[model samples]
Target: MTASTPGGRRVRIALQLQPQHAEYRQIRDTVLRAEDLGVDVIFNWDHFFPLHGDPDGKHFECWTMLGAWAEQTERVEIGALVTCNSYRNPELLADMARTVDHMSGGRLILGIGAGWFQKDYDQFGYEFGTPGRRIARLAADLPRIRARLAAGNPAPTRDIPILVGGGGERKTLRVVAEHADIWHSFSDLETLRRKSAILDEHGAAIGRDTARAVERSVAPHGEPEQAGEALVAAGATLLAIGVSGPDHDLTRLARWIAWRDAQG
Candidate 1:
């Protein structure tokens, strides 16, 4: 597929409603509101435990939440900010994603990664292999996932956009170049620039259109006007602002929404 212009492409904003320390009802309510407030995407993290706050805080599984979101929201793409690829079989994950894609009428994005949280590994009994090994597994599994998605009974509503989240200069980026429709990272400007160039180099090995093929994605910092412009200049157009649960404040998200609306 041909790539779209990086900076010139439509700017999109995503909200990562970290599924921790909140009731499922509360999270569901917030998901509904975020969509009405005009977010382009709504994401949850793929972790078995809370990433911060209470170590044993209330947390929900990622894909299940996405499945629910697929039914609940009429608009807004739903996915994990990045799903940990270590947890489920690539074929199973592919089937799950395809099911949700159909459920949402094609509003699904399969965000995935080589997982890093050791607690999820330890408690869930998944091996806490070295980072390189985990990345290698991710690279190896992606093709299987693609094949499974293709082979599934009832094809997906559309080619599901696989979003890969990582910054490793070698393995991770290479995987991103090969499979990711969107490449995500939590990098500052310099890091975004540097690692993006590295991704381009890797993409070149596969004839990836660094400027057009893979969309750049990142978190927002500071004011939306300033942060959004800076990230876009650095080649990131997806501004995903993360928020915690319980209150699940939308102050930042609202501001970003206004910022995105103001862009038009």
Candidate 2:
């Protein structure tokens, strides 16, 4: 029921428990149920306001909740599905991730992205920069983050895996090629293939062996029996299922876990 099977192949399925319209207690209970159900990773999103449902719905801050999750779950990697780069200083973010990494005994995945969601910026008093500017900032900040992580007091429990989500291609894929331990894609099949090749090309241009080095990540499109094969064939080993708040449905999660198990 861990990530790895008896056949030596690993099936890494993640549940992104959307932090919207749900109380902390419901979220906490779901986290426990998910770990018990054998998800390889559990994720929450980085947003100050609800992305759906009521505009003024209940929501929790991302990093603080991650600190709680680090203590709550004994297994399953915990992180934001993608934290906004523009929200915090890169060095500070690095230290927070390191602290949570230690808190979770090294089970943190630093999933990051260029800032989106205009309302979050507007409400939280952060800049709502252009896409180019945002990504440029993320690109510039990654090295600083790495340097800070390297210089931290105790250092990370392990090389914390960086999962870079986008807002891909021209700028983002290149960043992923250079720095990311996992490259996430939620695009369709053709997009997945095309972008993946571009990601490889970026890796090659930089001499980084990206296609082999970065783990390909994707969310399931349909039934796991059907979607899983194609996704794996397309080189996505990580399946991140989005579970919206108020329900945090696990029916599909159970189905995918069943599919993953049958792979053995």
Candidate 3:
């Protein structure tokens, strides 16, 4: 979903409610607070086990929680940081996205990526293939996902924006230039500058309009203003901050929201 903008530049704030060691009530409330604070998007991770410190800590599934978020929150887009392609069939995942999009009045961002967590693959009995193989699968399935979404009954109210999250200089970014409406990555200022240049190169190679075709997003770890300055200078307009569930930190979110406002 696109955000309200000013000065002809798009600025969006996203908070990832990482389901590391959190209860359902905590997760639900975080979503509520995100909307209350005027965050543009609220996200959760798609994993069976905890991603932070504990492998066996409290957690939840991705799509189910998205369904709940769709019902619970009155506004604010919802999605996974990047749903692992190994978890479900591509068509089914597309249908799941459509369902959530409808449930949320089209406030859904379909963030997807090539699966990487070996532990998730091992514990869930999914084949943990080589990195090349995973990207190949992701590349192949992206079209199927779009086709399914188009064919599904009660289609999404809007073309649910597909977000491809990764910074791989080769295949991943190329796929981003081809398929994603939103491209998400993690890097410092210099790295983001270099990589954005490379992404433009790739988009040129593919004859895609990189400048206006895709929205650039980054994951910010520290103070939002500092991070936001670096990333925006590097051509990023969407900034995402992660807050683990059960202990959702609105402190950082509030700061980022303020920073986003201060930019105007």
Best of the candidates, lDDT: 1
Report the lDDT of model 1 for residue 28.
Answer: 97
Question: How many clashing residue pairs, candidate 1?
Answer: 1
After the best TM-score superposition of candidate 2, give how far the Cα of residue 259 lies from its true spot, in angstroms.
0.6
Q: Positional deviation of 161 in candidate 1, in angstroms?
A: 0.1
- Candidate 2: worst-modelled 10 consecutive residues by lDDT: 1-10
Best candidate per TM-score, number?
Answer: 1
lDDT of 3 by residue, 111-185 (tens): 999978899999888889899999989999999999999999998889999999888999999999989998888
Which pairs clash (backbone N, Cα, C closer than 3 Å) in model 3? Answer: none
lDDT at 144, model 2: 96
Summing lDDT over every window of 10 consecutive residues in candidate 3, give the lowest-scoring window.
1-10
What is the lDDT for 150 in model 3? 96
Query: In candidate 3, residue 136 scores what lDDT?
Result: 88
Please identify model 3 stretches exceeding 4 Å from their true place. 1-7
TM-score of each: 0.96, 0.96, 0.95
lDDT of 2 by residue, 100-170 (tens): 99999999999999978999999889999899898999999999999999999999999999999972688
- Residues 51-146, candidate 1: write the lDDT tens digits: 889989999999988989999999899999899999999999999999999999999999999999999999999999999999999999999999
On lDDT, the stronger of 1 and 2 is 1
